[model samples]
Target: MAGSSATGLATLLPGAAEAAQKGVLTGFDLARRQGFPMLRHGPFGLIANPTSVDATGVHIADILHETAGVPLAAMFGPEHGFRGSAQAGKSEARSRDARTGLPVFDIYAKSGDALTAIFRAAGIGCVVFDIQDVGVRFYTYISTLFDSLVACARLGYEMIVLDRPNPITGLDCAGPVMQPGYESFIGRAAIPIRHGMTVGELARLFNAAFVPALAGRPARLRVVGMQGWSRDMWYDRTGLIWVPPSPNMPSLETAIVYPGTCLFEGTTLSVGRGTTMPFAYLGGPEVDGAAWVAALRRRALPGCVFRETYFTPGFSRHAGETIMGLELIVTDRQAFAPIPTALTMLSDALRLAGKPFWSDGGRTFDLLAGDGDTRAMLERGVAPERIVAGWQPALDRFRARRSGYLLYS
Candidate 1:
């Protein structure tokens, strides 16, 4: 059944074979070429953000609004809001888009019946989702995707996902899968931390595997798959321009390390949120930069090097205070294992701190890691390699389960 569904999905993508012969073409680009037949289900609301733009840097909302016969009636913003004006854990208040004058709804941190009510209030027949995902499990965009799918499933609204590349190549599936009871917006479903799949592929997986259980039936979902994208190509290799998916995720470099370093958010350490480097920089007010660097270097983790550095973040965590730590530079992305690298860093930091490293009694860390076991093991001075090794069986199962949903070769 799954194989047939996969084949059906592949057939739905027009020009997919021809697209592979050319340059990378996003699902939105292909949909535009087809005159957006999806929009024929009129008065569709868009759930998008800054990253929802085309090859030419034009925002999809603007393009659809200008296109005659396209019923781009409403807009919805996720974590950072529609225009991306809000900071982390916050979203823009409900307002009208100045450009399109369309009503904008806030969907961040919202789920279940509340989310369904918002969709019902929009008076739209269908929902269009087109946000660029960085391919990490905890990134809120994917959470928004899951919640929106649940709401759509309940409301019987079809969701057309305009897919984009997983900025970090969709090849390596690493880190721990979220446990049953530890579900949060950061991880609504049980997938690995580094889920090596695109948004469209994930949409398919969610629709078939998870949504039926949550919404009592799968959402009506169609993924407009990308053309010319494969499992091994990274975002920089794609010709598309980089738009910061969120204020903190500034570049491809940041996206590369994000799957691991983002776990720092659960700790006392700063993930360099306000700094120019963001996830590339890790530090805290009390960290010993030289000692941390030496410890990391001793591990000699693959495909990366560390430089002792200091910086005063302009905003989140240690804001206006000079932090002592290191800048992680990935020398070879192919060999780099972000999850293990971060675990090593975390273990070393915990040893050096002489204090509790976790915030909120390590609950947040456990939530991000997808279980309390990881935190308990790290606290017990377990080796990062051993912790990573423990995850392999589960990771293998996840890879097998997700194989049918992969769109690229």
Candidate 2:
């Protein structure tokens, strides 16, 4: 009842309320207390996007160039372009940054010789990655960071990571580990679906795991961490700006539903792209929203609710056609786990359809879930609760292994 009196967390966990407010810190804020003084005269290339801003909305790249004279040699664009213009599955090629006046290279798809060439051409002594990650493994910004670190190692450049909050708390790691063969651009490493580690914490893990693969051999790594960040805090608690990392991820509300709804992307259901709502709505042309919501309501999944509705997406999957689906309302983010929520919905939806209700691609859910286990469980008529229970052992093992690399508790 101590934290609960003023914070209203009396029944909730001790730190639950504070954790909700503190999200990822902005790069400009990080620079003030971080080792930014040294970068004032150093040659540097910024690996960042529009989200790398100060608390008051000052862009980090502009701040570094105008004030510090760090010589912004090359601007490395992540999944989204330097200005956050590109879409999913594609990276913006070389383009002129209107604000920074620097050559923005596309590192979204660059690798091996191409990556080596980018650094060699820029000839900068240090490479700094300051992009924001949604704290989910499927979100690809962290993968871009990993690839850049690999490049820095190979090119013998000083790799300094400016720390940001994980947006999600770093305390909870959930979902199945990325098995060996399922690794793709979306998942470059064997981390959980919700990795819960900040980009800096992940950088520390990379230094330990792939020391041999680092380009220059040894990890020439340095991390400038935040002063007030804690492992218990989530994004909203950080008092940082919430810039949508991509087009589909419209808000933290949408992101709360994404971990599960995203698996629908590999299927025929419309995961609500191209419309203003984005991931907030999920439905397909053949879906019966009323029936689906009614069925899901019976399950009474914790911390979430479903609103039966009909929608038409402008593009992406079921474009321009009215479809019935369910809208996920996450009333309690702390108690809601998107992975389990999604699995339950997907299983229920499949069963309700009855006529083999999947889109043309059978078992495509396997790819999205990163293995056949989830799909097989769904197919074998296993409920969502059982499916989650099945993966607990693997998840536990991964947590034990990842414990060594954890920078924060």
Candidate 3:
């Protein structure tokens, strides 16, 4: 029920990338060139949103509809709705697309027999997923993908995933692995909070690792992988356009810090929701901006700097009340460790904000953190570093298990 974590700016341009100049072509682009012949078999559904666009900024649904005999039977919207018009915790009502005149259904929070029934009623033989993910566990889009996989496996429907870049890059994994009994809509498995794999690769992992264990078997899965993407290439390096996957995720910088700072959504603090800075700005009404900034600076977190700041949100936590917090300045994308930095920030914030620091009765934080251990450890006066150290073994095991699913080197 809570949102994601992290920080970023809109000004960072994508022209300074390290990859080749020819640009990375997404699965949707390649599928279009191949004439989408697979869809010629009657009807298939697309799970997409405003972010499912080609290199020239044309929507994939539009292209498929216009292509001769493509057979795009229906469209599906995830958490925020198909056009991404709805805000957090809400979705657009089921309606027909004004442009393509195709029926659009809402897939958020629907699963099992209910979900399979939707696909069957649409008369879709296959389901294609093309949403861009930020590579964090609590983002919900991935959770929707996980649920869809289970449903498809149960109903014997084929599933195709059009792979996209991990935006935050897929070179590493960090944060706590979700423990059993701690599963929520935000986390459906025991993977690390930052699972460091693209959606296609995750689909493969889900089919082989999670689905069989829970759903009784695997789905018919196919992943159309990217042509030139590698584990080290960041979003800018992909040479693709940046479409905000959600309202708050305005740029790639936002995605980078998200796996960490997004934990604030579970707290009493204002995670810059109504401000132009959003996740980049964090604080609460009781916070001492200067002291909090000083405490965070002393941690010497890599790849980032912190500054004392104050703001009043037009919406969400502490709205219209001026609050104090820190502004994250990311100096080195490659060096900035988001989970550690965010844990340290939380530790400092809790210590400084006193008794009423937490909100939602702490359930939200526990769910996003993937278990009760993080919140429990923090409440028991544990150092942020010590808490992070406790997750090493589990994180290591997850990394090893996930390697088999990696599509890019």
lDDT of 1 by residue, 245-271 (tens): 999888999999999998988898888
Task: Provide the TM-score for each candidate, comma-separated.
Answer: 0.97, 0.88, 0.93
Candidate 2 lDDT at 282 equals 89
- Clash totals for all models, in order? 0, 15, 8
lDDT of 1: 0.88
Q: Candidate 1 regions off by >4 Å?
A: 1-3, 6-11
Tens digits of per-residue lDDT, candidate 3, 1-409, equal 0111111100101221433656787777666656775567778999999899998888999989898888898999998899999877677889999999999999887877878889888888889899999999999899889999988888788888888989888988999999888787899888888999999888877788888766688888777767668788899988899999998888888888888999988898888886878788998866788998999888888999999888777668888988878899899998999999999898888888866777878989989998888988887789989999999999989988887667677
Ten-residue segment with the worst summed lDDT in candidate 3? 1-10
By summed lDDT, which 10 consecutive residues of candidate 1 come out lowest? Answer: 1-10
Q: How far is candidate 3 from the true structure (C-alpha RMSD, Å)?
A: 6.7
RMSD of each: 1.8, 7.0, 6.7
lDDT of 2 by residue, 1-409 (tens): 1111111001111222333454444434656645466476567888888778778788888877786546678788878687888877777888878876888888886766788788778868878888777888778888777777777777777777777777767777777777777866677777878877877777767665754454546446666656456777767777777888887777777766776678877666888887767777888755678988998899899999989777888877878888778788888888988888888888877776645455555545555567767777787898788888888888888777667655544
**Which runs of model 2 end up more than 4 angstroms from their true locations?**
1-28, 38-41, 211-218, 354-364
Runs in model 3 deviating more than 4 A are 1-21
